[model samples]
Target chain A: MTELLKVTGLSRRFAGGGLFRKRKVFHAVSDVSFTLKRGQILGIVGESGCGKSTLARLVLRLIDASEGQVTFDGVDMASLPRRELRRLRQRMQLVFQDPYSAIDPRYSVRDALLEPFKVQGVKLGSPDEKVASLLDMVGLNTSLARSYPHQLSGGQKQRVGIARALALNPSLVVLDEPTASLDVSVQAQIVSLLERLRHELGLTYLFISHDLGLVRYFCDQVLVMYLGRVVEVMPSDAEPAHPYTRALLDSSFEPDPRQRRTITRLSGEVPSGYDLPAGCAFANRCPRVSDLCRGVLAPLSTLPNGQQVACHNPLIDAALPAACR
Target chain B: MLLTVDMLRIRFGAFSPVDQVTLGVDRGEILGVVGESGSGKSLTATAIMGLLPRIGGQVAGGSIRFDGTDLVDLPESQMRRLRGGRIALITQNPMTSLDPMMRIGPQIDQAARLHLGLGRSAARARSLDLMADLRIPDPASVYDLFPHQLSGGMKQRIVIAMALAGDPELLIADEPTTALDVTVQAQIVQILVDLVRQRGLGLILITHDMGVVAQACDRVAVMYCGRVVELARVDALFEHPRHPYTQALIRCIPRNGMARGTMTAIPGMVPTGMTQPPGCRFNPRCARVESRCRVDIPELLVGPSGNGVACHLAEAA
Candidate 1:
C-alpha cells in the first residue's frame, strides 16, 4: 500500500495564565506519528478530552501544528504558502461532528453545497445540475436543495454535510463522529451510506469516534489514545495488542442477554492535562502497571504483522509468540 | 411489589406525554426501560418520583402506588419526605447535578443528615466509608475536593454515593452511563448492579442503549410513543420480540460479528409530540402495519410466559 498522508512527531501546545506570572504550558498533542494509506480508513478512538479533535484539525491545517511535519501526496502541507494551501483544500475536506452546528441555518442545502465551488471560483456549466447530482449520490432528493437546515431531520442534515464534503471530489475526508447524534436506527443508515460512498468513490478517511463498536465496524486500522498519547495501534483483522484496547473491547456489552463475562474495570480517573504525571500517562489507572511502567515512558514498537504499540508490557502474549516476550 | 404504575397518564398542556403506561418494579428487581429519545421514559420516571416540572405537565389520570399509598394524591410536604427517603433518582449528567462550589464530602453528608437523620459528624464518617466502598482512590482527599476537581467518572461515583446516602428502597437511574466512555460505563454498571444486589433494592434503569439494557436488566420494557409497547423477560425478548417496533429496534443494532455495511435500518423518523397519529402512534413506521392499526388503539394483551404486548398482530396471535 502506498502512503497518502504521513504525519511525524506532530505536537500542539497552548500557554496558560496571565502575562504577569510565568505561563503554564498544556501539551494537547504529544509527539504523535501515523500514516494513512491510499483508500484505507484509520479510526482514532479516545475519550472527550484526549485531543483527537486537535489532531484532526492539525491534519486539515484548520489549526497549525507547533512541531513536526505533515506530507500529503509528496507535498509538505506545513510548508505550503497561503495560495498553495487554498488550492490543496479542494483535494481534502472535513465533516464536523455536529451536523446541526456545521451547516449554516440561513443557507439552503443547495447554497451550502455550492459554496465550495463558489469559493474556488470554478465556473461550472450549471451549478444546479452539479448540486442535484451530489444530492442523489448522498441518497437525498434534489428537491431538498431548497430546504433550510432546520427543515431537515438529523439524518438528512448529515447526508447534506456528506454531500457538501464531496462537492469538490476530495480524495481524503476526515469524519469526526458523523453518526453520534442520530438515533440507533438512523445511525445504521448513515454508517451504511458512508461505507458505500468510500467504496464507490475510492476515498480515504480519517474517522474519529469514541464509539468502539462503530469504529470496529468502519475502520481498517484502529488507534487507541489516552491522555493525548497513542496507547495501541492494531489492525482491524487481529486482536488488540494493549491492555487498554482489550479493556475497551471487553467493556462493549453484547445485545444478547444470555452472554455474561466478568469485566475488569480500570480504577481511578483520567489525570488532568494541566498536571500530567511524569511516566506513563495511564499508570494511575492501568491495572497491569509495573514499577518500570511507572518510572519510564514507552516508545512505539512494531509487532510481527506491522502493528505498532506504545506500552512497556504491550500485552505481548496477545500480540506475538512467547519467544518475543 | 414496591412500586406499581397502573394506567398512568401524564399530560403536558393539551398533549399526553405518557398515555396509559403501566409497569411495576418488585422488591429486588431491576426493570430496564429501553427506548429512543421522545419516548417519554424520562418523563415517566419523573412523574413517579413527583419531580415533574409545573410548566405544562400534570398527572392527568391513573395512579402511582408506592407501598400501597398513592403518590399522585399526596401533599407536597408529605411527598417531599418520601422522595429522598424511599425513592432516589440518579441522573445521567453528574456534573450538572452536583454543585461546583460545594465540597464532595459535605454534599454527600448533607443528604444523609437531611434524610437519614444522621448527625453531621456521623454523616461525614459514613460519606468516607461509602466512597471507599465505591473504590474511589484516596477517599479522604476526594472528600475535600470540589466538583470541578473530580473527573467525569469520579463525579458519577459521587452521584451514586449520594443516591445511596438515604438507603432508599428504590433507585431510579436515568441514562446513568450515556455520557461516559465504554470502559467507564461497564465499571459503573457493575457498581450499580452490586449495590442493588447487596441492598436488595428495586432499580429502574432508563437508557437508549439496548446493549446496556440486555446486560444490566432482568426484565426489559420497550417504550414507544409514551407507551410500554412490549414487556418480557430479558432472555425471552431478545430471543423473540413480539412487537414490530421491538423487532425493528433489535435488528437495527450492529452486532459484534456482523459484517460492515450490512446493517438494516428502519425507515422514517419518529413523529413529533404535537402531531402523533390518532390510533397507533408508531403505525407510520411499523413495517407490519395494517388498516386496523390506523383506526384503533390496541391494549396491552397478555401473551405467553407473562409477556405483555400492545400490537394488533400480537393481540390477534
Candidate 2:
C-alpha cells in the first residue's frame, strides 16, 4: 500500500432547518479528492469555514460523508462490514486542535491513553508499561500520568493528545491544527516533536493549519482550500498557482520586518458558506477576476510543475520551472 | 512619550503574575507586548487601562505615567474619567466588549457621547465618520446593522471605530485580531497601522504572535514569566535577539525559505504560577544557562537608544 489513503469525490452536506421549513442543505465539503502516500505529510492550509476540519473528520469516518469513497489500504471504507470497519479504524487516528477540550476533564493522562485500548477491547500485555512508554514517546514525564487535563499546560496537554493517538501505533495520523492553540515556542516544540515521532514511527500525517509559513516548513505538499473547495495543491517549496492561495500567502505577516510589503488588503468579505457563490468562491475578492471566473466553476487542472489549480485565471508564473525542487 | 510604565508589578495576594515590566510608547508609535499565556502581557495592558482592580490584581510597585501624570496615585474617580476618555481598550472578542442587543451604529456613538459628551446627532455623525475612516463599505447602512448581522471582520472594524470614537491619545488593543481570520486579521492590522500614522495615537497592542509584532509594531517588548526580557526596535529585536528567551522565541517561528528539520524547542516549560525560578526566569530553558543565571536576577539594562536585553550573558558580553 504505497498510497496509505485515497479519498475520492468527497462531499458532505449539513442540513439546516426546522420542522416547518424545507431543509436547506449547506455543502461543507464538495468534490474533495486527494491521495496520501506512506510517511508523507500533506498540509492543508485555509481560513475558517474552509471545511478542512470537516474533511479530517470525514477521512477518519468520525462523521459520515454524504457522498464519496474513502479507500484506505486497498479497502473501501464504505464497503467494509461493521466488524471489519472497527478493526480498520485502529490504523487511522486524529489529533484534535484544542488541547483544552479534546481530553476528558476527569480522566488522568494515563487513563486517557488507556481508554483507547479499552474501547478497542484489547490489552497490550501490560497497561502500566504501555502508558509509561507512550508518555516517554511523546517526551512527557511519566510522573504526569496521574495529572488531569486541567492540571497540564497547553503544550503538555497537546503532548498527552499525541501520546494517546500513538498508543495504538496508527499508521495514518490526522493532526488538525495541532499547534494552533499553542504559543510559538511550544508550537515549535510540538512541531519538532511531531517531526521526530514521524521519523521514529514511520507515520503518515495530514497536517491542517491556517499558517502558510508553518505549512510550507513542515509538509511535503501543500493543499490550499477556500469556501469548502480545493483551490490549489503544490509542492511545499513551489509558488502557488491559484489567486486565493496567493492572497493567503500575502496576508500572512512575515517574522522579519525587512520583508514587509505594503499589504493591499484583499477587498470583500468571505461569502457565507450557507449561501455559497454560484461560480468561483474567490471571484469576489480576486484581483485578476474575469467574466469567465464569475460565470463558471473551474475544474482542477495540473500544471507542468505537477501543481494543481482550480482557477480560470491561474497565476501560472515563470516560477513554475523552479517549483520542481 | 504618550505613556510610560516603569518597573510595573502587579500582585494578587501572595502571587505576583506581572513583575518589573518597563516600556514606553510615543504618540505615533506602536508598542507590541508579546508573550505566551500567563506571560503577563495582557495583564500589563490591563494595568495600563486601570482595569486590573476589576480582576483582583493590584499594582504592587512602579509607576504608570501617562502625559506626565502618575496614574499610580490617581483616585478611582479620576481614573474613571481617563479610562475611556484619554485611554481606551479594545479586547480580543468584540462580542464581550459589545452589547449584542444594541445596534452597531449606536454602539460606536456611545463612546463619543460618553467620552466627548457630544449630542445625539453629532455623536452619530462622528460615528459614521469614524466608520468611513476604518474603510467600512456604506457606513450609513452598516451603522443600522446589529453585531450579529455583520461578519467577524466587520464586527472587528466596528469595534475599532468604537475605540476611535473616544478620540483617545492612547489605545490599548488586547489581542484585537486573535479572534478574526488571517485574511481579515491582515485587514484589521493594516487599518490599525494606518490609524496610528494618520492620527498619531500611541498604540499598545498585546499579542502572542511574533509575525504581527514585526509587521506592525515600531518597538516590541518580549515578555516572559512576568518580565520584559527584551525591548528594542522591531528591526533590531528580530535581527539581533540578545536574550536567550528572545532568540529561542524567534527561532521557533517557521520562517519563509527556512530549511526543514532545523527548528528546535526550548528545553523546559515556562515556570507557571508562583513556581518561578531564581535568577533569570528563563535559566531552566536557556541553552546557555550559567550558574550566574540561576543565582542572580538580571534586570533589563537599556542603552541610550532604548534597546535592551535582560540576560546575564548579554549583560556580561
Candidate 3:
C-alpha cells in the first residue's frame, strides 16, 4: 500500500506569556506520528481538549507545527513554497463539524460548492453542471443548489458541506465530527454517503470524532488520544489494549438494551495540557497504574500482536501485566 | 406515580411546538424522553419546571400533577417554591446554567439556601457535600473556582450537584451530558442512577442519544415532532420496537459488528412547527407508511406487555 500521508513527530505548542508574566508553554499536540496509506480511513478518537483538532490542523498544514514534519504524496508540506502549497491544497480538503457555521450563511449551496473552485483558481467545463454533479455526488437533490444554508435542514446543510469539500475533487478529506450535529437517522445517512463516496471516488479519510461507536464502525483503524498524546492505535475490528482506550470503549453505551455492560470508571479529570505530569499523563486515572508507570513515560511500543500501545500495564486479552504476574 | 403529565400542550403564540403529550414517572424511576432536535423534549421539561412563561411559552391545555397536586394551576409564587426545591432541572450546557461570575460554592449554595431555606454556612456545607456526592475531587478548591476554570465534564457534575443540593424528589435532566465526553457521560449516568436508587427520586432524562436511554432509563418515551409516538420498557422497546419511527431510529444507530453503509436512514427531514403531516408526523419519513396513516391519527394503543405505540402498523407488528 502506498503511503499517501506521513506525519513524523508532529507537535504544536501555544506559548502563553504576557509582558509582565512568566512564559508558559502549552503542548496541544505532543510527538504525534502516523502513516496513512492511500484509500484508507484513520479515525482519531479522544475527549474534549485532547488536541485531536490541533493534530488535524497540523496534518492539513492549517496550523503550523512547532516541531516535526508532514509529507503528503511524497512532497514535504513544510518545505513546500506558499504558491505550491496553496495549489496542493486542492488535493486535500476539510469538512467541519457544524455545517451550520462551516459555510457562509449568505451563500447558496451552489455558491458554497463553487467557492472552493474559485479559491483554487480552477476553471471548469460548465461550472453550473459541475455544481449540480457535486450536489448529486453528496446525495443531495439538485434543487437545493439555489437554497441558502439557513433554508436547509441540518442534514441538508451537512450535505452541502460535504459537497463543498469535494468541489475540487480532493483525494483526502479530513472530516471533523461531520455527523455530530445531525440527528442519528441523518447521521446514518451521512455515514452511508461517506462510505459510498469512499468506495466510488477511491478517497482516503482522516476522521476525527468523539463518538467511539461511530469511529469504530466508520474507520478502518482507530487512534486513541489522551492529553495531547497517542495512547494506542488498533484495528477497529479488535478490542483496544491500552487502559485509556479500554475505558473509552467501555464508557460508550451500546444501543442494545439486552446486552448492557458495566461501565469501567476512570477516576480523576483529564490533566491540564499546560502542565503535564512527569511520567504517564493517564497514570492518575488508570486503574492499572503502578509505581513504574508513575516513574517513566511510556513510549508508543508495538505489541506482539502488531498493535501500538503506550501503556505500561495494557490489558491485552485481559491478561495481567508482567509486574502483576 | 410521582409525576403525571396528561395531554400536555405547550404552545408559542399560534405555533404549538408540543401537543397532547402524556407520560408519567414513578418514584425512583428514570423515564427517558427520547427525541431529535425540536422534538419538544426540552419544552416538556421547561413546562414541568414552570419555566415556559419565561421563554414565551405556555401550557395551552393539560394537567401536570406532582405529588397529587396540580402544578399547572399554581401561581408563579407558589410554583417558584417547587421550581428548584422539589422539581429540579439539569440542562445540557452547565456553563450557561451556572452563573459565570459567581464561584462554584456560592452558585450552588444559592440553590440550597434559596430553595431549601438553609443558612449561609449550612448551605455551604451542603454544597460541598453535594459536590463530594458527585465524585468531584478536591471539592474545596473547586468550590472557590469560577465556571471558566472547570472542564466541561466537571462543570456538568457541579450542575448536577446544584440540582441535588435541594434534595429534590423529581429531577429533570435535559441532555445533562450532551456537551461532555463519553467517558464522563457514563460516569454521570451511573451517578444519576445511583442517586435515583438511593434517594428514591423520579428522574426525567431528556436526550437524543438512544444508547443513553438503553443504559440508564427504565421506561423510554420516544417523541417525534411534539408527540409521544412510542412508550415502552427499555428492554422491550429495543428488542421489539412497534412503531415504524422507533424501528427506524433503532436501525439507524451505528452499533458494534454492524457493517458500514447498511444503516437504514429514514428518508426526508423531521417535520417542524405546524407543518407536520396531518395524521402521522413520521409518515413522510417512514418507509412502511400505509395510506390510512395519512388520513387518521393513531391513538396510543397498549400491548399486553404495557408497551404503548401510536401507529397503525403497531397492531400489524
Candidate 4:
C-alpha cells in the first residue's frame, strides 16, 4: 500500500488549569495511530473534545506531539530540521472548520489566494494569473477576485479556503470539520467540490468530522476515537466493531420513522479527558462492558476483514494489541 | 388544529425574508418545519410566540390562529398570558435560557407560578415532578442544583422541564438540539416526542435536519427562502417529495450503505432577502425549471388530506 502518511503511537498532552507547579496533564490525544493511503480519504470521527482536531494539528506538525511520531512519505517529521520542516509544510496543508473565520475579512478573494505564495516567498510567473487559475480550480467565478470575505457566501468562503489549501498543491490536506458550520445543501456542494479536487489533484485527505453519516459516505476508511484514543479502524462499508463506534452511528437520526432506532441510548457524560479510567477509557459508557473490560486496557486486535478494534468485548472478534508501549 | 399560520408574511424593515408561510399543528403530534438558514422557519415560530416585535420584525400580512383565536393582532397582555401558558417556546441554546445564578428548581418553578398561579411550595412540587418525568437522575437533588453544574444534555432537559412546567398546549422548539452533540441531540428529540404524545400537546419542531424530521415529526413542512414549498405526512413526504427543493434536500441525506457520489448537491445558494428571486425562489437552482416557473408565483395548494405543494410543476402533475 502506498501510504502517504503513517502516524505511530501519536500522543498530545496538555497541562490543564492552574499556573506554576500544580500540573495536571490531560492526554488530549493518546496512543493514536493511522495510515492515510495516497489519494485516499481517511476519516477521523468523534464527538466534540474527542481530540480529532488536536490529532489533525499533531499530524500536520502544527503542534508537537508529547509522545510518538508522524512519518510522512516514510520520513520522520519530528526529526526534520526547521528549514526542511518549513519547506515540507507546503506539501501538508490544513483547512479550518469555520469558513467564516478561516479567511481574513480584510483580504479580498484575489489577495487570499495569493497570500500562500507570498508567505512561501515563491515568485510566480504572474500573481494575477495564478489567482485566476486557483479560483477557476475551485469552481469560483474569476470576477469574485475583487470581493471580500463579507461579500461571499459561506460556501464561497469555503471554496476560497479549499483553493488556498490547493494553491501549494499539497499531497496531504487535513480538513478539520470543514463543513460543520455550513448549511446541509451548502455542505453537499463543498463535499462534491472536495471530491472533485481530490480526483483532479490526486490528493490524500485526513478528514476530521463529528458527523458519522458524512464520514461514512465520504471516507474510504474510518477511525473512531473516544476521548483521544482510537477505538476502531474499519473500511467504510464494514459494520462498526466497537460499541463506541456503534453509538456514534446511532447518534445521527436516520431520515425514516419506520427505521427509527428503539430507545437504547448511550447515557452518562463523557468522563473528564484528564481523569480517564484506569482500564478502557470507554468502560464507563460501553454497553458491552464487563469486569475484564473495566480492569484492563483493551488490545487493538485486527479481524480477518482488516477491521481494528480496541475493546475487550468488541462487537466483532478483533485484533491483538498492536504495541501500546 | 391547535395552531394554524395561514399565508404568513414577516418583514424586517423593508426586507421580508419569509413570505406566504402556511402550516398547522394539532395536539398529540409533531409538525416539523425543515429548512436551511434564512428559510424563515424560526421567524414563523417567533411570530406564533408573538415575539416578532422584539426582534425588529412585523407580521406584514396573513394570520396566526391558536385554538380558534386570531393571534395576529392580539394585545400584548393576552399574548403574554398565552405565551408561557399555552404556547411555550424552547430555543436552541439551553445554556442561555436558564439563569446561571438561580437554582434549577426555582427557574422551573417560576414558569409554573407565573402561568398556573401555583404557590411557592406547589410550584417546587410541580418542578420536581416535571424534572422526574424528564428522566433526570435524582430529580430531587438536581432541582436544587444550578444550571452550570449540569451537563449539556442535563441542562437541555432542565429547559424542557421548565417548558413543561408552564403546562403548555402547543410547544414550539426552534432547533432545540442544534447546539448539542448528535448523541445528546437524539436524546433531546426523544424527550420532545414523548412530551408531545404523553402530554397530548401540539409541537412545532423547527430544524434544519431532515433526518430529525423523518424520525420525530408526524407531519413536515419543507420551506425554501421564506415559503413552505411542500407539506405532507412524514411517511408520504419521505416516500415521494414533490417540490424540487424538497427532492434535492432528500437526495442530499447520506443514507446507510449509500454509495459514493450518490449525494447530489443543489447548485447555487439560497437567495437572501435582498436577492430574492422574481418567480419561484428555488427556480434558479432547480433542474426542471421552465419559463412558467420563472415568471409567476405558485400558490401553496393544500389537498383534502392537508398535504400541500407550492410548485407549478407539482400542480401540473
TM-score of each: 0.95, 0.98, 0.96, 0.97
Write the number of the candidate with greater DockQ, choosing between 2 and 3: 2
Q: Calculate the i-RMS of every candidate, to one decimal place.
A: 1.3, 0.9, 0.9, 1.1
The two-chain DockQ for each candidate, comma-separated, is: 0.71, 0.85, 0.82, 0.79
lDDT (10s digit) by residue, model 4, range A1-325: 5988999999999988687657688989999888888999999999888999999999989999999989999899999999999999999999987654766789888888988888898999998899999999988999999998878888999999999999998999999999988899999999999999899999999999999999999999999998899999998877888998888887787877678775566756788887988888878787898998878898778876678989878776323233421
lDDT of 1 by residue, A1-325 (tens): 8999999988888787677987787888888899999999999998888899999999989999999888998799988999999999899999976765866689999889998888998888998999999999999989999999978888899999999999999999999988888889788888888889999999999999998777877788898888788888887655777777888888888889887557776876677787788888888878788898888888988978677988887776777645665
Q: Write the per-residue lDDT of candidate 3 for residues A1-325, one digit (tens) a residue.
A: 9999999999999998788999999989999999999999999999988999899989999999999999999999999999999999999999988865866678888788888888888888898899888888987889888898768888888888888888888999999989988889899889988999999999999999999999988998999899999999888877688988888888888998876777766877777888899899999999989998888999999876678899888877643335543
Top candidate, metric DockQ? 2
User: How is the predicted docking of candidate 1 categorized under the CAPRI scheme?
Assistant: medium
Q: What C-alpha lDDT values do all the predictions have?
A: 0.86, 0.90, 0.89, 0.89
lDDT of 2 by residue, A1-325 (tens): 4999999999999998779998787889999999999999999999999999999999988899999999998889988888988888889999988754766788998889999899899968889999999999999999999888888888999999998888888999999999988888889899999999999999999999988999999999998999899999888988888988887888889899998867886878788778888899999999999999888999998988788999998888733774453
Candidate 3 docks at the CAPRI level of: high
DockQ: which is higher, 1 or 4?
A: 4
Which residue pairs come into collision in candidate 2?
none
Chain A TM value for model 2:
0.96
Q: What lDDT score goes with residue B236 in model 2?
A: 88
How accurately is candidate 2 docked according to DockQ?
0.85
Candidate 4's displacement at residue B156, Å, is 0.9
lDDT of 1 by residue, B16-54 (tens): 978878888887889999998888899999998897655
TM-score of chain B of 3: 0.96
TM score of chain A per candidate:
0.96, 0.96, 0.96, 0.95
